[model samples]
Target chain A: MVEELIIAGFGGQGVMVMGQILSYAGMHEGKNVSWIPSYGPEMRGGTANCSVVVSDEPIASPIVTEPTTAIVMNRPSLDRFEPMVQPGGLLIYNSSLIDRAPERTDIRVIAVPANELGEEVGSDKVANMVVLGAYIKARGTVSFETVGQCLAEVLPARRHDLIPLNLEALKRGAELVK
Target chain B: MAGRKLFKGNEAVAEAAIRAGCRFFFGYPITPQNEIPEYMSRRLPEVGGTFVQAESEVAAINMVYGAAGAGARVMTSSSSPGISLKQEGISYLAGAQLPCLIVNMVRGGPGLGGIAPAQSDYFQATKGGGHGDYRLIVYAPASVQEMVDLTLGAYDVAERYRIPVMILGDGVLGQMMEPVSFPEGSEPENAPQRPEPEWATRGARGGRAPRIVSSIYLKPEELYKHNLRLQEQFKRAEAAETRYEEVRTDDAEVLLVAYGTTSRVCRSAVEKLRTAGVRAGLFRPITVSPFPYKALGERARQVKAVLTVEMSLGQMVDDVRIAVAGAAPVDFLGTTGGVVPKAADIVERAAALARHGAADQATREGIS
Candidate 1:
């Protein structure tokens, strides 16, 4: 099976990092994965997005024009990616920031109050992690345990102190989705 | 456990070049490819190698020439416009028969184009952008893993032929991150020393004659002989280094010919075509210069039509047509100015080509 996604948000919202973490989780589960950011000038502000592909077999293209899933953490992201989700696919957005709901009726849309939940978990810095947790719950593409293990691999030793907080964020967000 | 680590394509290439015993890197900063030199700058110092962010692309390539001349494995990388700036030096290196790695993380270009990815440099890379009759062996990697493998392999190919080798990647490949594993026993921290070349400009010893690394021949006849020698070397490389990947081409009614980023899209397209009951296959040339013409020619004999898909207007299509040699009608589908064609569209175009055999070449519209 293959799951293609776009994770989009502001430059500081950890959109690329979320995509990378998901890719790492896919790798931890012994799957082929790729993460391609919208680099250059587009990455300067709220237009930051990354395309991610996770597959049982070799991944062909890292690009996803029509993603099966979209994790939009801001309103601009919601505006940009809501319609691009394939029919019957998932659109997980941060409801704390986006006011308007996705207009598409053909897709599954999950409105997670990611910022509120991130604050509830400990820090608003983990907002992307909260969205990621919801993404894991909604898609089940990679296990939470695999994501935690991937965190160990991705987080530098100097930043190891934050792993528990991030893990708490992941768990709390997943609990919200449940 | 699988030996895998996540890496951005440019960073992976830098680490792989280190693993390949490249002790020197000289490059200028360019978007979509800056990570290469940035990684090298950090890592090379720890390994006792050199990383110089030269003043300009011209200076950087000349430094590569100097380093390669001293028998050191060296590399330089840049985006399309920067790469164009280094053409004069590249031609000089080619003429002098120096071995070095040059990376072109191609961006959209005619002059300082946008930092978005494109394969518009196809002609500039494969058709010898520099003056004089010479060709640099070009490797087009579709994945980050291939980015690592081909970066390492490019050094070997360069050294084997005493010529410059190019890794022609687009911004898409350079900026992407993927899981990759280097070869077994290729630890980058303490890379093994590569043997110094006998022809290197090392200080003369043991009463041996001093070697001259010169590309200038005063006489026309002498220059003609030198050109012939270079051509012979190129021919040898063509015979030995024509690498390609053919997927599901045995009974395909249509063949999609692509390289680099475009090839990856075509691979996805092939899967879609199969689901739609279309007999489509892909012929991806790993070496863009020694371009798997023979293999493509053989596949062309079996396929009803050949569709050349690229991120450019249609540069590589000329080579595809030459390889197909009228065995099958050749068609083209591509974009330019950094707009990438979608895989679904590639499938649709190929399927139409499969059904209709071949449409008029002039009727094909460029995907914006």
Candidate 2:
């Protein structure tokens, strides 16, 4: 199976880090994965996005022209990526930021209060981790245990102190989807 | 620890170059490739190498020239416009027969174009952008692992031929992250060394004659002989270094020709075409300068049509036509200004070509 996902959010929302964590976890699970960020000027302060692919087969293209899932973190991201999800695919949006509901009826939609979940777990900065937890619950592309083990690999040693908080956020997200 | 780890393309290339014995890195900051210099700055010091951020692209390339002249494994990286500024220096290095690694992580445009990725530098890179009858062995790697492999291999090639080699990448390849394993350096640090070749510019040793390295020859005959020698070296590289990959082309009715990141998309397109009951394959040129023309033409002669897809306004198509040589009708589908084409569209075109057989541009457009 192949999972082509696009994760988008404002620059400080950890969009790129989320993708990297997933990619690292996917590799730990013995899968081929690739992650490419939107490295244009938008990366400074504006919206940033990344394309991630995890597959049982070798990943052909890292550019996601047709994504199976679009995980949006803000209103702009939701508005931009809501319609791009393929039919019977998934659209995971953060309801804490986006006001309007999704317009696409062809794909599955999940409105997650990622910010609330992150705050409930420990720190609101882990909102991206909250959404990632939900993503893992919905797709099951990589196991949460593997994600927990590989979080240290994706993050630096100094941030290792925050692994427990991030793990709680991932657990809360997975529980929210369940 | 190096068995497998996630790394950004730029950072991975930097570490790989370090492991490959690259002791000196000189470059100016440019968007999409800034991480290269930034990473070098931090890591080079750890390995006892030198990283210099030159004042300008010109100065950076000249610094590369100086380091290479001293028999050091040297490198310089830049984007499109920055690369253009370094053109004169690149030509000078080629003329002087210096060995160095030059990286062009191409961004869009003719001028200061967009910071988004594009392969528009195809002609500039393979066709000799700087000037003179000179050619640099240009490599186009599709993945970050290949980026590591080729970056390490490029230095050896540059030294072996006593010529410059270029790693032609773009924003996507430079900014992306993937799991990669380096050939060496699992211990996190190694002593970077600068090997002095016999022709190095070090002061005449042991009463030997002083070596002078210059690209200038006042006499026309001297320059002509020098040019002939360079041409002979290029021909030898063409025969020895041409590399490509053929994916399911034995019975392919239509062939998709592409390189670098674009080739990965075409690989997916090939699978889509086969699923749609069309016989399609891909020809990926790993070495763009010493392009595998003969191998491509052999495959092209068997196919009904050839579709050349690129991230430019059909630059590589010229070389594609030359290689096909009318064996099959060659068509091009290009998206310029950093717009990457979709695999679905590539599949549609290849399926149409496979169905209609030799669907020229007009005929393919007329199908609908």
Residue range B134-236, candidate 2, lDDT tens digits: 9999999999999998887787788888779999999999998888987655333654444578788978869998998889989999999999999888899
Q: Report the C-alpha displacement of residue B40, candidate 2, in angstroms.
A: 0.6
In DockQ terms, which candidate is top?
1
Candidate DockQ values, in order, are 0.80, 0.71
**For model 2, what is the error of residue B263's alpha carbon versus the real structure, in angstroms, after optimal superposition?**
0.5
lDDT of 1 by residue, B174-244 (tens): 99888999888888765666676888998788898999887899999999999999999999999999899
Which residue pairs clash in candidate 1?
Answer: none
TM-score of each candidate structure, all chains considered together: 0.96, 0.96
